[model samples]
Target chain A: MKVTHAKLLAQVPLLTDLPTELLESLAKSCRFEQVNRGHVIIERHDTTRRFFFLLSGQVRMLDLNRQGQEIALAILDAPTHFGELAVIDSLPRSASVQATTRCEVASISPQDAEKLIYTVPQVSRKIMQNMATVIRNNNLHRQVLQQQSISNRLAAYLLGQLPKDIDPKETVCIRNLPIQYDLSILLGTTRESISRALTTLVDEGLVTKDGKNLYLNDIPGLYQLLEED
Target chain B: MKVTHAKLLAQVPLLTDLPTELLESLAKSCRFEQVNRGHVIIERHDTTRRFFFLLSGQVRMLDLNRQGQEIALAILDAPTHFGELAVIDSLPRSASVQATTRCEVASISPQDAEKLIYTVPQVSRKIMQNMATVIRNNNLHRQVLQQQSISNRLAAYLLGQLPKDIDPKETVCIRNLPIQYDLSILLGTTRESISRALTTLVDEGLVTKDGKNLYLNDIPGLYQLLEED
Candidate 1:
């Protein structure tokens, strides 16, 4: 892919204040690959060699138990970066990353990435800023997951999608949200708990459910649920 | 403190690589304060504007529940940085920090910290790297805490403190190690569990306990416990 294509990959908060030229240069060096669904891009404890950016589809970051139960950590969608921590810390992969769908990913080996950063200081700064945002968001998410209860966590998770001071009457479309199983893992709860919470919301008329989709019926009630003791 | 003192402070991994003059300037602006035991420096969700560096003594970072139960997250010791996350993210404090001992600390306002970072690029880079390390360590600790049983966690915790390839016959001192309560929080287990594990080790002649101190008597045994299924 041309370096111009990489320009489309940078998100606002993650790569804020970067010059277009730097991003173009970075995109030029990235090696793009198409991976099938369920393909493992990286495995836990593997040597850290490459950093990957998702161009399309979803990737799941997860850890496996000795008995082979997988605990999903985070899901990386389009325009998101992963495996950078390994490069930064010079450590082995802390978890496994696998394609949840047919994924188009661009990767830069650590050696190449470091060389680019050294040669292009602007790109390095932008990358650092991007990493800082990732760390901050991860920490905030972990904090919410640790402190909030299952129900409150579900409400907060939904509220997180809406803007602060959202209109009470505004109906929120939830069909495009990530998979329920992914949500359950991210919130550190079971799928049954998530389904039950969604059912309760629907029963209370706080949300409307149709097949696999949902829409907010009472945003105020949803907010109240989030605030409940 | 003199410029030399500031330079010495900059020797910390977080501040290393910053310009000497910038370090001197930041040190000059820092306010030195003494905190008595039980003093709260930062409160969870508090909109405080100051950040701290532990110059001497221990400071405990804790998460508080609605019922007012406190869970210790980390213990900040000499020359350690704290409160940088809140400053960087421009968010309310996520955890409370309290003095666990009569200690001297240096503090800087968020504004000044930002100014120093902007003016001294190296300082900003160092700060970013430091925060990254903290995030990585925090995640690793949480993973270990969540996955391991209390006994295994305690054993892993102890084994982590020992040097690799230590002789099985060598006695390792634990007097300077963190207090039991702090250890309990670190391992995400209870004080009773820690006590019981210690007692078991003592009974098996794998460790010796005297007053508040412990000595490792069987390094291989501790490692085996850490590796148990």
Candidate 2:
């Protein structure tokens, strides 16, 4: 789908909070690009000239291990903003972002982003708050993953990815699991470990898998698993 | 130790950049507190009404695993600032901070910190830049640690803790080792792993260990080891 001006401006999380006039200005400054799956949208060491926000589809932020294996940092979906670090620090890109699926993304020039920071306090504060949230949550998530148990890591990883606003009683259906190989990269483990953990979760009736969809029967069960020695 | 108006203001990294009038205002707003070793300066759910800067001695940021084992996050020395995340986001403290030694720490209320942000653009920019640097470096460090090598982790970790301005060619001394238990917690490994990794480094002449003092004989050797796997 082509990214329409008003629709996209109002849809993106970054611009959605702005007033109509500011949104209009943002819309004017943004350039929308459609990228195919497997497109490397941003490479490590890329210039700090522009920031990106996903309007649709998925993107993976990743790094390469010394052995040339891809280590997944984050798998981001629509309404997500990234690359702001480069803008804030005026530094080269620290990681690579690639399209995991055909994606619609909006790019904003750093000059415009900086102008927004000074001219628009509300937007600036929101961005900073968002960054703080990411930093804090990412730190917590990494701490969970650092433990030596693959089961605990997978459980904590799944729980961490749920939206903050997700209803406690809601049965969250996650169907976009790419594949076991991809999941292994995300957890920094092997495909065998991912499969083993999934089997255990299924055997315990904590979660059920049907085709590409996974169902959480008991969210607290996952937490209980983490508490196990 | 009493916190003199000039001495305290000069030592705190946050206030050092401000002009005299501003520093005077900040010094007045700050509360200088001397804490003893093992003092719990901040708890997990503490309010973010104030921020802290260490004037002297060591502070450790830590968390408890489900089994009640401690997980070390960071060990900070003088001229370090923390709890700004709470101040920035108005969120509860994400972790616990304990004084690792008798410490002199100065704190500023969020209200005063806000005043500085409005009154001092350069200082605010510098704080943001520092925060961005933290986020980037933390991400990289976590990535390095997540790989499955205890020796690589200890090497990368020591290299990481070195002051960024340290001369690459100079023989820098880091004598503030926090014992084997704390080192194991920081690396999410067994105490035995820490001992083994240290022995390996010493054996290879990559680093030399003298009592609690560990000396890096060749920093590049550690980096090369990381590149090997």
Candidate 3:
């Protein structure tokens, strides 16, 4: 395999599992592109016939309502993929994707991606598994974000990041949260409101913040706050 | 084919398109069950091993945040399917499914469903297509609900339900929205708040309440309102 093709395929967990021959075939069809920060990879309601897998950098899926208030649906890091809807059904883009940072992405024509899935059994299973994962995570996230209360939203968001096997009483540190401004956008609140909510959380003994990292010393207490909402 | 089996298979839009022999084979492994109103067909965090297809009746997909605030994800009518995550990958149920009305349902083991998807090309394509449809609708619904304001939320909700082919200037009546209580739960607001939003829409000449229906007289005006918020 070519070094660049191998690197891109290795980055995406889904493509790494494909057999060498199939990977070689897919790599041959792959087109490499570099997108600048704030570049819109796809636009809402555009009927385009392409699928993109982010090889490096960050991509934000943006939703802008009629009032022009924009919220992010998701922020995807490299090795993650987008645009599978058009790949599957030629559907118009429902949301826009913009590079949150200068990014490298590998492009595949919908026809090429469809051919990989339809004609290759192993590739089909791997692709389906990846799609299932996207659907599962999306449902779980929508459920959490549906909470009405800001504190509840924050608590739920925190608890969601905790390791599943961790005990409730253990101290947990959550890192990698979006900054306050972006978080407010995701939670549909103002920066001031989000700050106030965090302060309230701190006063209530649910969490402590050390810069960008948050410490949860009373995990069960936080659960109680979420439960009592 | 058994008459009951054929009847059940024919009712499901996803399965009706499959060959009769294949459907018959699938029906052989099916287990029929009757769920009462408010029956919990699936539970969040439950590691259940089956996927369900609603043969007759109404079902609500629900999400309860850690705060115990419950919201309905969707209200699915018969001839619809759910729980493919477990079938495809044996993942735990991410959300709950409850019977909104007394209902009849047929279930297939994940093993059996996997057999069909892996061995039958047409069945695999059909299932994937159905999944793509679900993912697409989920993304769109999430986008509409991500807006920050209640009035904006209500307006976006109404606009989303409009038929795609309708002209922007045309008159449209949206009916069968959840009752105020349910709408409040779904929209993350109080019944009083939802009422206020609707009244505001009426006062703005964007929507006119006619009995149980909402007549959207100027679709663009409603959209403009959505943009301004």
- Which run of 10 residues does model 2 chain B get worst, by summed lDDT? B1-10
**What overall lDDT goes with each candidate model?**
0.69, 0.77, 0.77
What TM-score does the A-chain of candidate 3 achieve? 0.89
Model 2, A1-229: lDDT tens per residue? 2235656767766667677766766777788889999999999878855888798999888876655667777788897788877888899887899998899988888988677654465656666677677677666766666767787787777777576687656667677766787778877788999999999888988788889888777787777877774
Per-residue error (Å), model 3, residue B66: 1.8
CA error at residue A6 for candidate 1, angstroms: 3.6
Clashing pairs in 3: A66-B226, A66-B227, A67-B226, A67-B227, A226-B67
List candidate 3 segments past 4 Å from native: A1-4, A147-152, A190-212, B1-4, B143-152, B175-184, B189-221, B224-229
- The lDDT-based order of candidates, best leading, equals 3, 2, 1
RMSD of each: 4.8, 3.6, 3.3
lDDT top scorer: 3
lDDT of 1 by residue, B1-229 (tens): 4776686557555677777786787788888788899998888888876767777788888875333446677777777777766666666787888898998778888899666544455555566556556666655554444344666666666765676577777888777667778777666456887778667778888788777677988887876665563
Provide DockQ values for all models, in the order shown: 0.23, 0.48, 0.49
Model 3 lDDT, full chain set: 0.77
TM-score of candidate 1 to 2 decimals: 0.77
